[model samples]
Target: GDDAKAAQRVVRQWLAKKGITAPHLVMENGSGLSRAERVSAREMAGMLQAAWRSPYSAEFISSMPIAGTDGTMRKRLKTTAMRGEAHIKTGTLNTVRAIAGYSRDINGNTWAVVAILNDKAPFGASSVLDQVLLDLYRQPKLPETASVL
Candidate 1:
């Protein structure tokens, strides 16, 4: 947590030095575990838009999940239509289970998706979230941000 805090401060300073005006950006924790934290859906969308505008978009996209290989998405999406096709980050807490990622449709349209599930116990957490992702991949496009979780 300290590392993330320090990094956030340092980044904000660097961005300021570069003449970029940004928000306070209260990332309670880089991993989003703090209970009092608030993240606007609009800001998340803007981040995705910014990523698209970055010069290294190709590198960013390619570095994403390869389905069965690395990162939090490694165990999942083994042999499905999403194999080596999506990169998502999963978060879990007492009352939280969330995932956000990018998926490119067959038509080559890339969509960024975020899904969150809360106010529930861990009784069947893993299976429940797995089903969420399966449904999303099964559907046409990664539905809107609030569609599948």
Candidate 2:
């Protein structure tokens, strides 16, 4: 998480001055691993959109895991179309499955989606439904450095 206390706190504070309220902030560890935290779909997208237009967009994008390359997302999602075209971050646990990232279509329209599923939400017959969200960004090609993650 690029909070105001980060080295690039100036960038984070700039967004705050713009009336952007990052409420519902349960991210004490920065990483979304604790079972005590949750965020709305809308709020997650707002952060993604902000990162895209922010000065730290490149930094944020570069930190993501490359599909079939590195990080947790590399193992499960080895799809042919997603191998190189997609890059993302992944997380999993007995009570949680989450993925969040961006995907740029051929038309150059970058669309970001963050989906979260909780087992206690009563989504279906099974109460322990943990579906992993593998967010991937589709681009023309993966850069040389990212070819290996």
Candidate 3:
């Protein structure tokens, strides 16, 4: 569609400015709503990691849904220890269900998590993604990169 193509152009220009050279990043509208778009879990994770390292990390993280508090995660993970511990963004499409966020672990370290499911019957992806975040919260510590800043 024209909109997707236009978004792709904008993303390309932004990526060029940022010196991000992802040769394999393809068919994306930067909105994750296009059927033609494709981003691997690893790529999404890398994006989250980069966001965490950026100077705007606090701003970006705060913009996401707060678990059991507001936005898309308002009711999710509500009954778990993960409640109020994560700031995440969710994506949904007929064939794609994804989540990306920073989850604060027990040790007060924030971990970036990105999970996506591409399946004909992706019925339980949200629950699975929530579990992933919860597991991160239960971890003894965030990944080593969390200490970089």
Best by TM-score: 3
Give the candidate order by descending lDDT.
3, 1, 2
lDDT of 1 by residue, 1-149 (tens): 78877988886776566455547356666556678665554455445555656798778766666556787778877766766666666777888776666664444445566566676676666567666556655565432554321
Model 1 TM: 0.63
Candidate 2 lDDT over residue span 6-98, tens digit each: 733563476477555556645445456666656776566677777777788888987997655677656544654445444466556565555
lDDT of 1 at 52: 58
* Residue 92, model 3, lDDT: 91
Alpha carbon deviation, residue 97, candidate 3 (Å): 1.1
Per-residue error for 32 in candidate 3, Å, reads 1.6
The alpha-carbon lDDT assigned to residue 26 of candidate 3 equals 80
TM-score of each: 0.63, 0.61, 0.80
Residue 133, model 1, lDDT: 56
Candidate 1 deviant stretches above 4 angstroms: 1-26, 29-31, 122-149
> For residues 1-149, could you state the per-residue lDDT of candidate 3 as single tens digits?
99878977887787666656656678754655778677777666667777777899889999999998899999999988888988989999887788887778877887777788889989988898888887777784545664421
C-alpha lDDT score of every prediction, in listed order: 0.62, 0.54, 0.79
In terms of lDDT, the poorest run of 10 residues in model 2 is 125-134
Task: Return the candidate ranking by TM-score, descending.
Answer: 3, 1, 2
